[model samples]
Target: MLLTDDIIESSCRHNMDFDLKKTLEALLLSTAEPILLKDVVKVFARYHQELSEAQEAIKGEEDEDDIAIEIPSLVTQAQIREALEQLTEEAQAQNRAYRVVEGPNGYQMVTAPQFAEFVRLLRGAPRPMKLSPAALETLSIVAYRQPVTRAEMEAIRGVSVDSALHKLIELELVIVTGRAELPGRPIQYGTTDKFLEFTGIKELDELPASDVLSNHQIDEWMRRSEEEPEEISDEDVGLSKEPKPDELALDEKFVEVDWQRENVESDAAPEPESNENTPL
Candidate 1:
């Protein structure tokens, strides 16, 4: 009898695992976009919790005693990954048009590359839309310094970016995330999922090194400075000037001063005792 019970318990556990796999497969197949593993796990957990609650409710109705119902084992990340892998293999073995693909964003069901031509044919010819140089520059700035504002973009580009920003928004490459907490509360912009899809990249980190642009800008500035040296008048001798290379290097290592903290402290500081008699 003990051995028979053990077999029954094992069969139940196997069925539970199979049901979890089916639920996960349904979720992945139904979603239009890639679903994160954490989200999938949350869904599974909530479902199990509800099931347990229902089971307990039925037990209460059947018996006057408030007995607890046994909850099945919670699905683990390992199980989800394993199920995804199995599904991918099954699709490949059957030569299915769509297959599960893992990318930096998440796991998505994408059409096989070999079936691209057929998909395009069914969708009809695509429209030709190319990004302009200004648009590209603005996009790069938004992609790198994400949550940047239009004013910031203009500052970096050294030109009016109203047109470029409009174009980017129309193309669905960039989106206004929120407003900066500055004086004007300017709208902040950031790249979108479509941007990733267009670039064929999964994550922002996949973009080229950011320091490359900084270095190029520094070189260009040096070149322009050499081409046109600023005139120093005799009266400007005592005035502050750009720091020397050694001083600049030292400044680089120094911690950034918090202007806001400094302002707050200055405001909070007690005013010096007024010398009314001596004051004019």
Candidate 2:
């Protein structure tokens, strides 16, 4: 029979079995929000006096135990389980939802996975955003340094880039798939397919090698930078448009310096003291 207000109210008012009344009340209560069998059982024990007598009869003991009766004996633990099962089946039949599953280490009431399509229809789904540049950079670093925290990235980049990281989330370039095992359990960021597209690379291996700038190349760049004056125009700067194969030959002949050794020597050099005692 269809569940209408008059039908439910009439059943409640006339010749109502305590079990049926409790079930009706449970259905009404659950209408306010998602309710579980355990919750309904608690209410039946508290409010239904006839259920208490029925339970005492089922117990088959005449002791004045003074125990607060909850579910009637007719609705034994096994019966309660069965009733809950029936309620769940009925809910399914009516295109309603009922289920229990583990969530974050505890059980929760959730719509059956099959009814997910219905819930999705009622509530519009969330769409992912595009990743931004800084998000991409953060994602790249995190990808290379799996399980790295935000602190590590900030230390390397020498800047606090919280905002950029948030933008990356908006773009879906970076996602917090898991947490680091550190004390605070900080979130770890990682790249998505969009990162590869943005970089125009098939994989992380396709990225340009850091070895492109050798010590000799660094020295050449420094020398060229120092000797070459700020440009005016090609004509005014005395720059030749003609190819200089000979310049390449000269460049090939130059011996490369060990920048590591030079770096130490440069650091060891003493600083010039202020000229406080200089002769007038």
Candidate 3:
């Protein structure tokens, strides 16, 4: 039967063996995206409320055949969590193609990784998205260091992020949140809901710890970036230093010696003739 409202209401009022886990399983399978825990609880709340209203309406002149079938109490969040856990276990036990996974946002039913190729084939998958390495790096910085400005991203990446940032914004993975309260009030960038969706994470906190940069280290970078920099020479960053007066003189002496030695070697026949005359 179709999952219509009246049908759901009827089920809520009439079902004797209502299984919470099974109800969630139905919900998970029905949704195209992850469902929030609070949303699931609210669905049940509304169901129970509607059932109570219907019960009250029928109580006035019910026929003898209408039995008082027990309606389940309002399901708690803990109950919902427990039910979801059971659903997860059940899916695993059955070696189902889909599994119930929970993330920061809520729970979702996703196809098991082992079935990815099958699903991909079923969907006639499109060409894989091509993100430039630079874009990925910029996206990572934004994901980990968000509420960050383009300047900060460039600082971390050691290059301009304009192109990469623009691409990410176009892809709906990143967005301009607000201006940073810095000297110029630079615009800050942040990851979007689509970013979490793309990454298969429910929220930002679910983002895995970065191996290249931890939060603390990023914080330090930001802190240092904020401070006024001291005067630095090219040598500070491994550039060649200008030769000092003494070093220049030393170099000139070596050049003079090398040049004289070259000239003397080239004129060896004349020197040998002078020495041969002395020997004679």
Model 3: how large is the Cα RMSD against the reference?
10.2
Which candidate wins on TM-score?
A: 3
List pairs with backbone clashes in candidate 2. Answer: 45-70, 55-73, 129-171, 130-171, 131-171
Candidate 2 — which residues are off by over 4 angstroms? 1-140, 211-280
Rank by lDDT, descending? Answer: 3, 1, 2
lDDT of 3 by residue, 21-129 (tens): 8788899989878789999999999987866665555565546245343456799999999889988898899999898988656898988888987888999997447
Which candidate do you rate higher for TM-score, 1 or 2?
1
Error of 3 at 10 (Å): 5.4
Q: Taking the tens digit of each residue's C-alpha lDDT, what string does model 1 give over 170-270? A: 99999989999999898999999889977867788888887744546745754675586778865589866766556776437556789999999999999
* Candidate 2 vs 3: which has more TM-score: 3
Name the TM-score of candidate 3. 0.68
lDDT of 2 by residue, 1-280 (tens): 2333333344355333556534643564455344555655664554455544444553644553642334433334456656555654566677655553222222234566687777777788653245667665666666565455687677555677698877776766667778878899888777765566455454655656544233355446546756858857666768766444566655565567999999999999999998999989
Best by lDDT: 3
Alpha carbon lDDT of each predicted model: 0.77, 0.57, 0.81
RMSD of 1: 20.9
Against the hidden reference, what TM-scores do the models get? 0.51, 0.27, 0.68
